[model samples]
Target: MPLVRIDLNQGRTAAQLREIADAVQEVMLDVFAAPPGDRYQIVTEHPAGQVIAEGSGLGIERSDALVMIQVFHQGRSVEQKTRAYAGLSRILAERAGLAPGDLIVSMVENTKEDWSFAGGRAQFLTGEL
Candidate 1:
């Protein structure tokens, strides 16, 4: 499973936030090949000034509608990640009316040994996942 964190400035309603989160989850499913119904996400909306997203000199415009996504998961290839980023940009724009220019994404990888679903056991190692 990929755990996704979506950080954006505070202006959207709860339904809108869920739409953004769902958009991220869609990328996890389609591009990252995560299993269905394995969604895990944290959507945090900061006050307008709290989220400072710069254009990174790429000239991509930043806005309060900026969406920063960090995905934590295991063993996805570079190609998968590349597609995931593209998919997020496209899907978020389609589903949430978010500008592709206003999106930023990052991924972090870990091993199965690093995850414990419950009971202090590594579910992947224990064949419980």
Candidate 2:
């Protein structure tokens, strides 16, 4: 599953949020060939003063937003990952209206062996009952 966290300004409507999420998911599907069922998105809106960018040397800009995406997949090579990143960045810049450099997107991989659900009692990798 891909869990995407979008931290943006507290001004967008629900429709805007849904559109952004859909665009992001489309990138993953197109670039990485991911299935629709394996994707999930969480958008969190923050107040003006809650987030700050250190390197900017100024207060956080209203337009600044952080998008973090964690993808759990199997056997994806560096080349594939690189392509996905590029595609995601481009899509976010064009569709989401975020400056390409300002958007901080990250991907994390996990083997089924390292994940669990149901209060950690059910191991995903081992299929424990």
Candidate 3:
């Protein structure tokens, strides 16, 4: 399973937020091969002054529409990750009206042992996953 965190400026409506989250989960299912109902996502909104996202000289103009997505999951191939990047960008642009330049994504790799879905037990290790 992957834990996804979405951070954005505080302005979008609830529907837009849901669309963004759904778009991300869709990519996880398609590219990461994550099963249905494995979604664990959190969305946080901050004021414009609170979120200081810059392009790092990439020459991309980031605005209040900036969105930062962080995914924590098991290791994935480079190709899979690259596809996720592209898929997320395309989906967000088409579905949520987010520009590719306003989206930032990062992934962190962890082992199965790092997760405990419920009952204070490691589902993967216990073969319950």
Candidate 4:
């Protein structure tokens, strides 16, 4: 399971936020092969001054529409991660009207033992996943 956190400048409507979240989930499903209903996402909107996103020498210009996505999950193959990035960029552009440059994504990998979905047990290790 992947837990995603979406951070953006505070402005868009709830529907727009929902669309962004849904698009991310779709990418996870397609690229990561995450099961349906395994969605774990959080959307946080920050004030203009509170959110600062720069290109970091990439020569890319970002706007207030910046979206930062952080995904925490088990390690994935480089190919899978690349595909997810492409899918996210494409889907966000089509569904949320976000430019590719306005998006930033990062992933944190952990072992299956790092997660305890319920009963204070590691579901994956227990073969309950």
Candidate 5:
């Protein structure tokens, strides 16, 4: 289970946002192997200057289209993470017209105990997942 958070500069149309989010979901499914229909994402649009992402000496530049994606989920292997990153970069460019430099992705790993699907219960821990 991966809970994705997409933060982007406020300018894109609704269709653009949907395309970007769907592209990410595709990567999560194809690369991360998330279960079917387990899609969970939160997309937040911020005004200009709200999201400041600068290249850390990589000589890369970011524009208003910068999209920051954070995935919180159970531990995934390094290979999976690498594939996910590459897939996101490639697929977003193809499907959403997002520049590779304008994208930032990060992953946080946790145990099943960290999740609570609904009803105030830790579904994964209670065998409800």
Candidate 6:
């Protein structure tokens, strides 16, 4: 599952969020080859005053958006992860209406033993399981 956290300047509508989701889903599907039916995303909007940016030590100025995407998967190689991050960053920059340097993505890979789903009732035993 991919947990996407999008932090944008507080002025976006529901339609904007949906559009971002669509663009992100497309990147996930095309770059990571993730199944269309198997994807998860969470979009969070933060005001400029609350978030602490990297360079400015302040919230994003202007109409900038801070996107922090975290991806979780099993048995993925470094190359795959790299490609996923790169593809996502590129797509978000190109399609999500963000500056190229504004998007930041992080990924964490784990074995099947690390995660549980379905209210902790089911553990992912393998990629297929």
Q: Please identify model 5 stretches exceeding 4 Å from their true place.
A: none
Q: Between candidates 1 and 4, name the one with more favorable TM-score.
A: 4
What TM-score would you give candidate 6 relative to the actual structure? 0.74
Q: What C-alpha lDDT values do all the predictions have?
A: 0.86, 0.67, 0.92, 0.92, 0.92, 0.67
Q: What's the lDDT of the predicted structure labeled candidate 3?
A: 0.92
Residue 89 miss distance in model 1 (angstroms) = 0.4
Report residue 16 deviation for candidate 4 (angstroms).
0.6
After the best TM-score superposition of candidate 2, give how far the Cα of residue 7 lies from its true spot, in angstroms.
2.0
- Model 3: which residue pairs collide? none
Worst 10 residues of 2 by lDDT: 54-63
- Cα deviation at 76, candidate 3, in Å, is 1.3
Write model 4 residue lDDT over 10-87, tens digit each, in one string: 999999999999999999998999988888999999998777887889899899999999999896899999999999
lDDT tens per residue, model 2, 2-118? 566766667777897787788878877887766655576677888876654444555534345655455655556788788878887788778877666555556677666654545
Sequence-dependent TM-score of model 5: 0.95
After the best TM-score superposition of candidate 5, give how far the Cα of residue 97 lies from its true spot, in angstroms.
0.9
Deviating ranges (above 4 Å) for candidate 4: none
TM-score of each: 0.95, 0.71, 0.96, 0.96, 0.95, 0.74
Kindly report which residue pairs in candidate 6 clash with one another. none
Report clash pairs, candidate 4.
none
What's the true lDDT of residue 121 in model 5? Answer: 96
Model 2, global lDDT: 0.67
Per-residue lDDT over 1-129 for candidate 1, one digit per residue giving the tens place of the 0 to 100 score: 688888889889899898888778888998888888878898888987887888778888887788888889998999999998889889888998888788989889999888886699998999987
In the range 1-129, model 6's lDDT, one tens digit per residue, is 544555566676888778777787887777667667666777777777665457555563433566656666667677777887777767766776777556666677666676665565434664454
